[model samples]
Target chain A: DTAVSQTPKYLVTQMGNDKSIKCEQNLGHDTMYWYKQDSKKFLKIMFSYNNKELIINETVPNRFSPKSPDKAHLNLHINSLELGDSAVYFCASSQGTGPLGYEQYFGPGTRLTVT
Target chain B: SQQGEEDPQALSIQEGENATMNCSYKTSINNLQWYRQNSGRGLVHLILIRSNEREKHSGRLRVTLDTSKKSSSLLITASRAADTASYFCARRNAGGTSYGKLTFGQGTILTVHP
Candidate 1:
């Protein structure tokens, strides 16, 4: 079974539209995170949630939001999608927070294309 | 706004050769981790070295950390064609409410030829 899985492996939309990507983990991790990989292959963290509670929120735009209804699920919702939003979004999960020797398991990634 | 930067953005090597990628970060860190990503896929965790530790080894992979210099290196020995991928270094910052948060480097693209 896949440890971390993301739905809608590919998404294409126009500007001013809203979209959501779903993520789930079977690792029973307590923490989940969302990361964006730009065309330049730079991976950056956008948000992090611990046990369904929002924790780390980077300097991402307010149009982007993350919701974790339960520990096993974390979803990203983007509003007013802009062309700059075209990139790969990755979802990851870990056992605990910080120095716990817990390695993060990543999903296959969702390629979002905004026109 | 990036904390880590990898050197030699790309590398090419023959089978059975060794490949080394270096990573440097600006802030103090609790640990440094290495990850590998194939084309159009998620990252795979390779190994992690704690700030207090100087070196670590796993199979054909070796990692060394220099806390004073805030740098780390990943050495892959006997690389094969299948080893071709992008390698990244991630750092866990020392001080922050975001303890588990990871800051990743630009990543080094490795091409191994048989």
Candidate 2:
């Protein structure tokens, strides 16, 4: 079974349009994260939620929002999308919360294209 | 901004040859992990080395961590064509509220020819 899954593998929308991507993890993990990979292949963290509580909110634009209804699910919503927002978004989940290393399982990623 | 930067952005090797990749990170880290991502797929966890550990091995993958230098290396022995993928080193933040959060490197693209 797939441990982490994401919806809308590909999204093509016009500028100013709004879109949402859903992520779900079945690994029984408590921490979930959202990352954006730019055209240069630089993966940057955008947001993280631990047990449904916001933990890390990086310097992302206000147009992007992340909602975690539960520990197993975290969804990303982008509003007023611009051409610069064209990139691949990934979701990941981890089991523990501590200084000790915890392996994260990533989703297949959603490729968003704003025209 | 990325906290880690991998050396040798790309590597090409023949099948049965060993592949080595290095990663360097800034700041204190609880541990460093190696992940592999095939084209058009999500990343898969390969191995992790803690700050206190020196070397770790899993199957054909060997990982070494040097906390003093804040650097790590991954060696894949007897690499196969299927091993052609991007390798990334991620650091688990040790301080602040992002303890368990991971900071990833730019990744090294490896291509193995049969």
Residue A99 lDDT in candidate 2: 83
Candidate 1, residue A34: the lDDT equals 98
Docking class of 2: high
Model 1 chain A scores worst on lDDT over the 10 consecutive residues at A95-104
Task: Evaluate model 1 with DockQ and give the value.
Answer: 0.72
Runs with alpha carbons beyond 4 Å of true place in candidate 2? none
User: Candidate 1 on B1-114: residue-level lDDT in tens?
Assistant: 466789889999999999999999999888889999999999999998899999999999999999999899999999999999999999888875764999899999999999
**DockQ for the candidates, in order:** 0.72, 0.82
Best by lDDT: 1
Pairs that collide in candidate 1 are: none
**TM-score (chain A only) for the predictions, listed in order:** 0.97, 0.98
TM per prediction: 0.97, 0.97
